[model samples]
Target: MELGVIDLVGGGGAMVAVNDSTRTLRRTRSIQLDHVWRALETGAWVTAGFRSATPWLSSITGESPSASSVTLRLAERIQQMPQVKATFADGVLAESALRQLTDLWSFDIAGEFARDERMLLGWALKFASGDLTMLLATWLLHNDPDAADKTAQEQFESRELHLSSLLDSMGRLDALLDPEGFNLVRAAIRHLS
Candidate 1:
């Protein structure tokens, strides 16, 4: 049964909603924030209107040369925020927000990462595959493209992989997006197009 919903703005920049069942609808609560609401509504409309998209927003966040270091740092901070993280865990953040947060978090995660026996991307790619990485990267960047480094340009410069192994193991960047996230990327591609 559809439950009655109440949007309740809380202290500390948080918004909450109590469903008829007393559970939270975090996505609905996020819409109470003016800027986030705008991002979500606009992204949703773009997706509905355009079915074919190129994920320009995602690309811009992670690989665009024009993005600056400061932007990426800001994105990382945003992703790390408690409210945003909670919303994300609850599946409330918009598609773009999720991508943006994921991208920024990746940068932070990557920096602290120490890989000896296990490569982070390799682990992700092996069991989870590149699509998951793609999805996570998309979410992180869509939330903030400027926050991601232009690693796309330099990925090859720094990474020395046995070409055969990489080719055999690497899944397509496609199929990475989760359903909601996929829709967001599609809208981003269309909006930019």
Candidate 2:
């Protein structure tokens, strides 16, 4: 028994069809939103392609559409924050970290420091790990206004040392690696800069 099928045609729209075996009836709906139809089509193609290429994904249920949709919406909301966008564009923030920050807090940190986006981006990039970045964002989100200023100052000072230690470790590793491998690392660091 056939269940349902959805077809998205570029520049046209989405065609959805449902078949009911018991009633011997078929229903169809056309969705005209081009952007929405295109997104759905892309998502379907990605899911089918991934499932076909990965043998294990066929056995286990893949990432749910609802979850991916939520993440995409959250990312769109986060991008509205100039500081968040800047950090992400600078390669200092990971998409997963931004999602975690969105899940942890509702307020806009970027709006809070609209004039200090550079400072905010610098602080965000100071964290060597995404977990640390999320923790810092959470701290900033929940801290009282009076304490936030002092806390931000202290966090920056303390985190600077941590970042310095991380850089030292990377430098040591770079010294040990082959010239070609170290050159790749240098290129990545240059790209981040």
Instruction: List TM-score per model, in order.
Output: 0.21, 0.32
How good is model 2 by TM-score?
0.32
What is the alpha-carbon lDDT for the whole of candidate 1?
Answer: 0.39
Which clashing pairs does model 2 show?
A: none
Q: What is the Cα-based lDDT of residue 165 in candidate 2?
A: 36
Per-residue CA lDDT of model 1 for 1-193, tens digit only, reads: 2222234454412323233212244443333233333444467436645331123333433532222222333334444345554544454343344444444354444443322112323333233334556655554465446544555533333232111223668643323334455577699989999
Candidate 1, poorest ten consecutive residues by summed lDDT: 156-165
In angstroms, the error of model 2 at 85 is 1.7
Error of 2 at 80 (Å): 2.1
- In order, the Cα lDDT scores of the candidates are 0.39, 0.42
